[model samples]
Each structure stands twice: as structure tokens, then as C-alpha cells.
Target: MTLSPVPDRALAELGRTEGGPDTLALLVRDQDTRRLLMLRAVLDAAEGADARVCSADARARVREDWALLAEADRVAPAGGGAAADRGSAFPGDLAADPASASARDTARDTAAGPTANPAATAPPGGPTPDPAAIAAAAGRAPDQATTSAGYIPPHPPLSPARARLLHPLVGPWARRCLRELGAAAGPPTAEGTRELAHDLAHFSALAAVAAARAGISYAVRLPARDGALVLPSLGVLRTAVPGGVPVDVVHRRGRLTLRQSGVADITVRLESGTGAWSAAPAWTPAYALPGLLSGAGPMPLDDLDPYRTARGGPRHHALSGPTTLDDAGRKRWLHSWSAAAAALGLGGEQRVGEAVALLRCLVPLADPPGSAGGGRGGGSCSGTRREAFGAVLSSTPPTPATFAATLVHELQHTKLAALSDMLTLHHAGPQERYFAPWRPDPRPYDGLLQGAYSHLALADFFQRCALTATRPAHRESAWTLHARYQEQVGAVLPTLVGSGDLTARGRRFVDQMVAVHERLEEHPPPRGQAARARAYVAAARALWAGRRIRPTG
Candidate 1:
């Protein structure tokens, strides 16, 4: 692969423009309090022009907004608990516990200085918080509170043992998610960075409402040009913070503070402060993306940042794409797929449902704490099935399209499993193994897995494209697998799609789909089998595009 040949400075600047994600590598070693205070002061200076809050009345309004946010959180379904429910470290039952800081709690309910997000630092016109900004906030975690970016997350990353103990707090299924997420965030590889960033961002978005629920105030800490930590003022000091509030976050002495962002902007006294951003006071409420809600596909990937809130991206490509699927929708994908597993006959059923089930089974492998596949026929022939099948899918949502795609992907796993079963099925005696199950082998995610995934992804995309190119809402049954005919192939998936560092499989998947999209767009949609035949041709060509994604499978 050829380098872009962009100059170093230009590249650095471009990287910064991409939100300076590498800023995470800069660790603040000095724990000195005074330096921290000065840093906080600097952050206060850079506060965006719109960030502002100076009056008690305005603070009160912010409080009301927080209350409404809390109510919304209560009503929001905690994702089918598929994700690990990492509870807030802020103490669930704080009233009776002596750990409760009287001043903190009082500060939580009523403070009259500024809103958690000041007008000066508010997004242009007070739109949702940017995902990049939220990510920078993750490393800016406050000094005393377990919360970050305005929310007391329900859980932190947990190990298997730790996850088990916290299951009651976050629930078993969520525990699995939490443990896996934690590992993903801190994994030893580059993809690990992706997972880590994604998790932090995801929770941070949720934290916006979570902070409101817990009545916690938050301030984002940013690094100054001089290398000091600056806490962006959400508007506490400029306004007269009311007293006797339960949670208080004061940024006066430096260091980002965590208090209820309601009425009083409370600040926690960190022994140190970074820099201070602008000091105005005003913040904005966040909501779902307009495009996604309306059912449009493909918004700029960056547009989803505000919705993400913290750092990183989604679990996989589809999830990470310019599309947004709610937690409930994600969980349903798992549930529906599980139900369809037995119906696929342990091979590609050429249906969306099969793909969905296959993906569900594969997702569990992304984590260690989650049990291995047992519910589906491909996993095993155990007498007692999965300890709790709902343990995984329960947290995911069930979307028809997503379910179909996931089922298709997972069926491949079943194929892998059945092949493994076949190895053992033909054993000459109890001592010999016939077929080698693909389960125990190392994953080829970066290799052949990438190739195969690319092929199928395009195959599916072409199927969709066939309808899309033809714009065929009118023809219901014209839908058919294109892999059956290869003569009219347009291009192979491997050569078509190109990414910076994709594995062979990844490259192929993107390649095949790209070719299909290009082909359908190039050739005007023909009527009947001709149109379907063209799509089939396009898919078959791409199906053979990528090289050995599964290696042997």
C-alpha cells in the first residue's frame, strides 16, 4: 500500500481535526493540586462563546431540565442487559451510607452558579454534545466522582470474577457485556483501541442522562496549549449557586468537578487542576439522530458522534456504520436469530433469519464471560442447552433487517460447528475424533474471516441492491440469491473495496459490495429476471472476489 505522502505537520493537524484521538496517549503524571487548579483556570478561558450561565433562575431551569432527563432515563429500557450494566461508583444507596459527602449531596440537588454545560462552551446553538468532545472528556474523568461527562455510569469494566459479583447490580447478561467491553477497551491490539474508545463513548452518551438521574454535575477537562489541564465551565461560579443542594461541583479551585448539574454547578476539589476553558454557562440536551429516526441509510459517519457521546465506535461494522440501531433493536436481532437457528438445517438457508442467528452465536465469542454457543443446533448437542439463552440476546434488540443479516452471518458459525460435529460424528471408536470443529481454533478475523465476511456482506448488499437499483417495492418475489449465477459478474469483492489496513476478508467484503453497488448503478435496472439476473451475476463475481476469508471453513 502506498502512503498518502502528506507532510508530518499537515498529518498531525489533520489528526487533530479528526478530534486528536491520540491525545489519550498523553498521560498527566503530575498529581499536584495547585497545578491542576491553574489548569482548570485555563480551560475556563477557552470556553466556547455560547457556554454561559450566570443567574440562579437559569440554574433552576437547568435543574428542571435535569429532572426531565432523569425521568426519561427511568423510562428508557436498560438494553436487554446484553451489554454489561456497569453501575455508577457514586454509591447506589448513598443516604444511609456514611461515605456520602454531605456537601456533595447538598450540592447535587441545588447549586446556583452555572449550568453543567455553560453557554460559552455549548455546541453551536446548543446542539447535542459532539462524540469527539465527549471522547476527550473520558480521559478527563473527574477527581472524586466515578462519573464522567455528566453521568454516573451504572458499571465500570469488570473481569469475569468481578462481573459475577456485580451481576445483581448490572445483571448477569449485562455483566457479560461489561466484562467484554472492558477487555475490548483495554485489549492488546489496535482493534482493542477501537473497542475501548467505542465503549467509553457509548457509556458517555448514556451518561448525559445518567448524570441527570443521579443529579451529578460534570465539567470537561481539556489540555491547554501549554500542557495544563483545563476544565470547561458548564456555568457554576459565574452564577450564584444555591446552597443545601445534594450534589455540588465547583470548578473554582481547578480540577474538573462532579456534582448534580441541576441547579447548582458543584465542583469536586481535585488536588490538581488542568486548564480552564471558557467560563460561560449553558448546555444542550441530546436526542437520537434525525436521519436514523426517519429510516434513512448512510449519514456521514462523523454525524453520529453526538449520539455516541464518549469515544470509539460501535461493536461491529453494521453497528458502527452510519446507521443507528437502539439497544432494544439490537437485542431483538439476537432473540429472533436464536429462534430461527434450528430451522436453517445447519447450513446456509439463503434467508435473512439464518444470518441473524449465526451472528448472535458469533457475538458471544467477542467476550470471555459469556457462555459459548449451546442454544443453536450448531453449538452442540448437549442435553441441557445454554445455561440461560436469554443471557446474551436478552440485552440485544430485535430488528427485522438487522435480525436477517445477523442470522445469515451466524449460520456460517453453525456450518463451522456442524463441520466440527461431523469430525466427531464419524469417529471409528470413542477414542478417535472424526471431524475437527472450527470452534477451538484461533479466529481469522484479520485474515480469511475478513475475506468470507466481505463476500457475504456484498452478496446480501447486492440482494438489497437488486431491489434498490430496480427500486422494486412492487415486485415481492423477484428477490433471489445472486451467487447462483456467476457469468454476468461485475467485479470481485476483494479487489473492489479498499481500506487503510483491512484484513483480507474485510477488504473482500467491502470490495464485493462496492462492485455490486457500482454495477447496479451503472446498468439501468432491467425488468424481471434480467434485473435479478444482473444482481445475481454481480454477487457471484464478488463472492469469489476476496481470498479464503474462513481459511478452511
Candidate 2:
């Protein structure tokens, strides 16, 4: 069965509550334009919410068209005549039939001298055809792009909104190259102009996909909201995109076309065939639409074989350490990510900041439960220097919550890895192994710090989930989970502080953590759950003590 990341049933569950994802339900009856505006307000309210996932340009464009539609509906011509020409720009009343739309575009390109932007057209309230969807419609599986040797579209054509959103981030460079290349030729040739338009559209699509996958946020500079817009340097872009081929520019007549021979299929169209920008446009914006990548749902783990040793990522020493999952395993893994994203308020921040990509290639462990993989249960890895990140599940997690927590745990590591690169956390301390509550063996001080911080983050996650949980049991369980993590950090925090191995900077960082922990502890977990948390901590320590403390003569 095809798994939906957020099914109607899941939304129904959220709608039962008064807050968080609950707000989405209220938007159901409103027009898509108004729905988008209302949703933006919610995304803006949350601190550190990744609003980049929604395209402001798309929203603005759609809003304008929506206004026009309202006007048309209000003053339908005397005979209830046809509305004004909406064109194929914004999907709504204006959406033309596919064959006719295609014919119009060709005619427009031929007659309009190609200066006009070939706006992506889609049906109202439907998903815009992305490459994957288009390819699927064409009888090719979405994975064909990866498995096949030749270029296949990376993703369906980005929606007009997404295209506009990504333009500012990468557009200037593309425009500059197009201008320079096109300048090489004489002025005003229809054929050349069309090529330039094609190149612009193609390059725009390529850049959009790259930006989405890279997970970098571009804080667009706006009046009254001047923040840093982080653009990827050429060097960074090389590492972030596949094949990393520099976009080759070619001049024809009076226009320039981008040659992406190796990276994408030349013949593929970048517009959605569904005619709708999204099946659930209003909900998607509030939920951070970009976070919902197409074709990312469940697939057999073995299908990832092509990417196991794929070029153009962080170089790993080992190719195969974990076993590949069968169909059942893939379903479980897919469900876990979907459930976690839904349960936790991770939509805005799903791929923001430190996350580059949500890695899914799993290598199962041969050793039997709990005792296998050197006593390590499931472990995840990410390259410290690059944005290559993913998890390695040694075994299926007992619950979706467990899998979700693991994802958060590993993401914390990536955050730290990125932070460590910017600021030195510790001095060159002695290479001495210290206690890590999770593992049986002693870890270095650095390792201990990462573990402790991750647990602290775990505590934070559960704490937040508890705040929004409607069910009494879920809330209590969340509190209990938080307490357990809080207790784990409490045990390890002191050793880290007293180790006398920390640099001044490291000490300050640790101090901040301690302060946060103290404040969090003040809001104690639900009564019985607190005691249960303490007991759980005690039990974990006893297990560790027995395993680590032997006759060390």
C-alpha cells in the first residue's frame, strides 16, 4: 500500500486537539490563497520555524490571481460571461486543458519573441507535475533516474511558486551567465530567444532542486526584515549538487541556453501534470511543503544499492556494514519517518540548518537483538566536513517513537558536528575514555559531550511533544521520556564539568547546558512519571556498572 506522510486519519487525530497541527483543519474550507496566508502566520509564530519551505513568490502570485478570481465571481459579466484571461500562470479558473495549454505555450514562444516567462501551469487544487510524478505518469519508476545510466529528471518541474522562491537564491548567477553568453550573439532572433528562455527555465529548475536537497536556508533580505541571505558559494554548490558539473552556457541568436547534459534529462518538462500545485496546498504551506519531497516514501532498502557507493558525497571507508532490509523493513522505516515528523513539531525545521539530506540506506545487523553490532543497538552517521547525513538501523525499532527519537538523536550529532567546526568546544584534552550512559564501553570526553547533549535534546523533544499531546497517557509518557533523558544528562554533566579538561569556551557551553537543564528540571514531570523516570535511570546505571566495572588490576 502507498504510504502517505500525513494521512487524513493523522490529520483527524491532530484536529481533535486545539493547537499545533490542529490549526490546519480550520483552513480546510477557505480558498487556497487565503489558506496560504493564514498558514504563513502560524509558521512565522513558531521560533526557528523553517518558513523557506514555502515560496513567498508563489504565495504572492497566487494571492494576486485569487483576488482577480474573487473580483470576477463578484461581477460576472451581464450574461455571466467568461472571466478575464487568467492565462496558464497561476492554476485556478485559468487552467487550460493540457493539449491546448501546450499548444498555447508553443504559439506564445513562437509569436511573443520568447521574452515572456513560460509560467508553470497546473490544475486548481492539484499537485504541480514534478519530474518524478511526470516520469511515473510516463510509465517509468521515479528511481529510474538513479538506476539508469543516462540523465533523468531529478524531480518533477518545481511549482511556479517554488521556482519563484528559489530564483532569488540562485537566480542572479544564472541570469548573469545567460546575459554574458547571449551577448556574444547579434540582437533579436526568435529562435535564439526561445533557447534563452528554455535555458533559464531549465537552470531555474536545476537550482531549485539543488537548494531543496542541500537544506540550506536563504534568509531573503526584505524591507523591515533584513536578515542575512546565505547563498552557496560556487565551491559549496559543487559539493552539494550531483555530478557537480559546472553549468555550461551556450549562445544562440540572441539568447543563452544552459547545457545540463550530465545532470538532467534534456527532453523532460519541469511542470506538474496534475494541474494542481499540490493536492493539499494549504496544509502543505503550513507544514513546510519543501519538507515533503516527492517519491521519498517507503522503498526496499536493497533498492539503495546504486547509491551505497555512489560518487559525489562524503567519502566513507566501508561500503557495506549493515544488512539491507526487505519489503517489511522498508515499510517500517518509512512509517517511522512519517509518524515522527507528524508527531513531533519538526515540519519547519525538518531539513533546515545542519541537515543536508535525510539518508535512508539501511544495513541490518547480523547479530541477534541488543547483543549485536558490538553491543551497539542502532547507530547513525554523518560526515563532519560535508553535509552527507543518514542513519544505519541495525534492527527495526520497537516503536515509531523510538525511530523518531533516533532520527532526532542523530540530527543532534550533525548539529554538533557543524557547531564544532565553527567553534572549538574543548581543548586538546588527553585521549582518555569517559563514561557514556548509553554505551557499555567508555567514550572519549568529546564523545561523552556529544552523547550528553544529544540526550538533553531528546529530553527537549519529549518535553515539547508532551506540551502539545492531548491524550493523558501520551502526555504522561512524554513527560516520563523527558525525565529519563534529563536524568541521564544529570549523571554525565558533573563528570564533564570536573574533568578539568575543558577549554574556557567549552566550559561556557557546558554552563549554558547546565542552566537550561536546571530550568527544565524545575517544571517537574507528572508525579508518578517522575519517580518512574528516576527508577529507569537507576536501572540503566546498574546495568552499566555491572558491565564496565570488573576487577581492573
Candidate 2 Cα errors over 4 Å, as ranges: 1-321, 325-328, 346-387, 390-400, 428-432, 546-553
Task: Write candidate 1's Cα lDDT for 346-454 as tens digits.
Answer: 1122332222211211122111123242222122111001211111221132222322333344333333222222122111222221111112222232323322433
Q: How far is candidate 1 from the true structure (C-alpha RMSD, Å)?
A: 22.3
TM-score of 1: 0.26
Compare the candidates by TM-score and give the number of the best one. 2
Q: CA shift at 463, candidate 2, in angstroms?
A: 1.4
lDDT of each: 0.27, 0.38
Candidate 1, run of 10 with poorest lDDT: 131-140
Q: For model 2, how does the per-residue alpha-carbon lDDT over 1-553 read when each residue is reduced to its tens digit?
A: 1111333443322211111222222222121233233323322322121223223443333233232223222221221233243232233433332332231111111111112111111101223222111011111222232233222112223333332222222222233223423334455466554443333333333332222222211111111001111111111112113432344322122122233334531111111211111222111100011121223322112222212222233333422234445445544444443333333332123311112233323334333433324223344332221222233333444344555565566656644543454345676455646766666666778888887877877776677667656556666767878888888888899988886767666676777677767867777788788788778778877877787667866
Worst 10 residues of 2 by lDDT: 281-290
